[model samples]
Target: MFRNIKTYREGALIEDEQIKSYVESFESELLRGISTLSALSIIQRHPDEGIYGYQLLKELEQETGRTLIIEEGTLYPILRKLERDELVVSERKDSGGRPRKYYKLTTKGTELYQHMVGFFSKLLEAITPLMDIEIKLPEKKFIYCPNCTNKIPQEAEVRFCNICGLNIEGLSK
Candidate 1:
């Protein structure tokens, strides 16, 4: 495809293979899936509840129905980065025996989260009508267990995922 384009430009004759490889790499970076939004969503739903690190992992896993791809190596560094940005703050909690660090979003973080939600909602609204599709809200449903992946039928402020054992805001499915 790029072979003909190379000759069309008089001065610069870029090779087809070289151009193809460069374009592919650049596109991959642009399409890489990142979930900073998921983190924001978690904070927004539970503004007052301080979230534990392990709980975040479980929540993400259950919500997406995919492995978070965040292993022992990368989790702490990302947490530190978020904390450094002041979007989230960490504190220690000693409940029964051991101490656990819980993360809570600051006021600025809350506002940012709400803004992101609205922006994405508006974007979806614009795209859907153009595609000739009708968007309908789903009825309320039970929260699925993050570990067991079982659905819990009752409505609660926060529901625990059985599959991964993470607490999540109960939203209408």
Candidate 2:
């Protein structure tokens, strides 16, 4: 009975299981590419104080409105890889009784995160026109970096140009 209403293949009716499988596969493949960036961004936000593994997962869920759910077991391997690459540094801290490892971004990681942000911005701008719905930028005028002319939104809380590494706090005003 359920299967009768659940299938679609091209224009014709098909099994719902096939559609579910296809969606799961597609989503997994896409998330695999962006997971590193997502993790990096979370770590970057808490630069001064490092965050532990479980807390990082919780933050990711909270920040993304729970849409980007990653399993607890999968998060460690990603953190280990980031540490091995020297993008992030980790140290063990004794909390209560158990030792929890906290991770923070290194200088290299911060620079890489900035680069990734710029890349993602440009990518979204390029693809906005192709999307079905119209997209709009904020009405406030954008500020360009005096050093490198990189355009930044007026509301951005950046102190330096991600592209040129120039201190822009004074210049933005």
Candidate 3:
């Protein structure tokens, strides 16, 4: 007495089990492209002490309020990519019991994270009007450089903008 939910895949109508696999594949593709930020932010959270994969995943879930649950298949690849990019470094350590590979942001990663977080915040604020949402970023705490407009925190001792090399020392004062 129930009707199947039909979805068009490529050209043909797909339903039931086929639709599930088709949709899942499509979902994974979409996720794979833009999921690094969450993982990066998690690793970025811990500076001196690095985080293991499982702990990072759990923190990611908590940070996003349990909305995003990333699988190990996706997380590991992203970590490897970040390591290859020199954005993060991993070390195997035996903290208390079993040895675990912990990941932490490199100096470059820290700078990149600042810029990315700033950009993301600005992007959210910029798109809020279109999305019919409101976001109030702390303007006083950040330095939106006049030259590049790359967002950065005022607390950081930055003389020139990391992205555009704009002189911001005077502006920081």
Candidate 4:
């Protein structure tokens, strides 16, 4: 027989079922955006020799210190979507006795990855000032627009953001 669920007014302890549901909801919401970007990055890394679904999943886990936990069943649909979007392409190859589908980024995908890198870099930079801990990017000789985070070469003398049209002359001073 199943136990009857009790309310707080009844002074019953919170059930394991309730806690599990809450955790699952929270994790799913948090990973919604991140999972797609992570998958794309994994595919991007194996450009010369494309990687299959299982291998891609393993590499993602290893690269993220096991923090980006994506389910095996969930990865394929994402791959299919990427292929449909023309961001990646896949080919089936005979490996030993089984046909494995390998995925690699297209030219468009590479461009997208670069754009995403800039976006995330700028996003983090904008928020780091408010955080208690300081986060720094690896030493690079590039400058980013404070308004739009558009990266410019250290040697460029541009006074405005090409993307957002924000005047950046003040930052140089």
Candidate number with greatest TM-score: 3
Q: Model 3: how far is 31 from its true place, Å? A: 4.4
Give me the displacement of residue 66 in model 4, in angstroms: 1.1
Q: Which tens-of-lDDT digit does each residue in 1-173 have in candidate 3?
A: 01123345665545456876877778767666447777888887898899999899888777777656687566898899999999999999997799999999999988877777777777788899998999998878888776556777788897889988988886744
Instruction: Give TM per candidate.
Output: 0.50, 0.70, 0.77, 0.70
**Cα-based lDDT for every prediction:** 0.58, 0.74, 0.78, 0.75
lDDT per residue (tens digit) for residues 82-156 in model 4: 899998999998877999999999997776665566677777766887886576763255566666566555566
lDDT of 1 by residue, 73-147 (tens): 456676777789887888999855978888888876664554444444445555797998865422244443433
Model 4's alpha-carbon lDDT is 0.75
RMSD to the hidden true structure, all candidates:
13.0, 6.1, 5.9, 7.1
Model 4, 5: alpha-carbon shift in Å?
24
Off by over 4 Å in 4: 1-20, 139-173
If candidate 3 were superposed on the true structure by all CA atoms, what would the RMSD be? 5.9
Better of 1 and 4 by TM-score: 4
Candidate 4 residue-pair clash tally: 0
Candidate 3 structure lDDT: 0.78
Rank candidates by TM-score, best first: 3, 4, 2, 1
Give the CA lDDT, 0 to 100, for residue 64 in model 4: 82
